[model samples]
Target: MKHAALTGISPAVIAELKNGRARTLELTSAHNIITLTEAAPGECIFVTSVNEEDLSPGDPGIMVDLLALNIGMRRIEVANSFFYEERERMSARIKVQFRGITLTRDVEGRKWGDPTKVEIVRSACYRAG
Candidate 1:
């Protein structure tokens, strides 16, 4: 039984979207943070979001896109994303296809930054889809 999963952020680079600097970590037994200039075309990657309900109760997987991540980062203007309580149960899986290699990450505490309050909550990443 595979309880742990790996996700990829396959798509255009989100560094600009994030507004903050985002470094892609090399996929190895020991996670290493690396920089991603851009994602090549025709590459396939997956971003999986899981909730507490799915963790213990078990349920379907949540689908998310890389554009959302970039948007959220852009909206917040920071690379460090924190999810709201509602989203606390939810986790994000980013699968990015850089060059010929595919990279992924399990991001937690992701949320949208409120321009007014500055307290970022509700991620726009999953808003579109």
Candidate 2:
């Protein structure tokens, strides 16, 4: 199967994500909520979000290159879908990254309603090494 291009992602994180070893990455900011459910090195980074009320017609949700994501304090760049007018005027995308990650405590203790407890604070994208 053809896969999406991923940049700046660490090999270890890709392995973990592909092998089902890593927890889901959930990030929240003042205006948006992002969830990375699945990912692979060359595959598309499956994602969903809330609070992004503005979407163009036939929008297929958010999809990004898994490798494009910089791991270990690296930033992820995404086009702004919430504000089309601003995006057109600026011709720029938003740069965001994760910080202060907290994984789920225990499998048994995880609630059915809320299985994962991963928490990532959203911050400005850092320079990728």
Off by over 4 Å in 1: 1-5, 8-23, 28-41, 49-129
What lDDT tens digits, residue by residue, belong to model 2 across residues 46-86?
22221123222232222333343322332445556674332
Error of 1 at 3 (Å): 20
Tell me, what's the RMSD of every candidate? 17.2, 16.7
State every prediction's TM-score relative to the real structure.
0.17, 0.20
Error of 2 at 19 (Å): 31
lDDT of 2: 0.28
TM match of model 2 to true structure: 0.20
The local distance difference test score of model 1 is: 0.24
Worst 10 residues of 1 by lDDT: 112-121
Candidate 2 deviant stretches above 4 angstroms:
1-38, 51-60, 73-129
lDDT of model 2, residue 122: 30
Alpha-carbon shift of residue 97 in model 2 (angstroms): 16
lDDT of each: 0.24, 0.28
lDDT of 2 at 12: 53
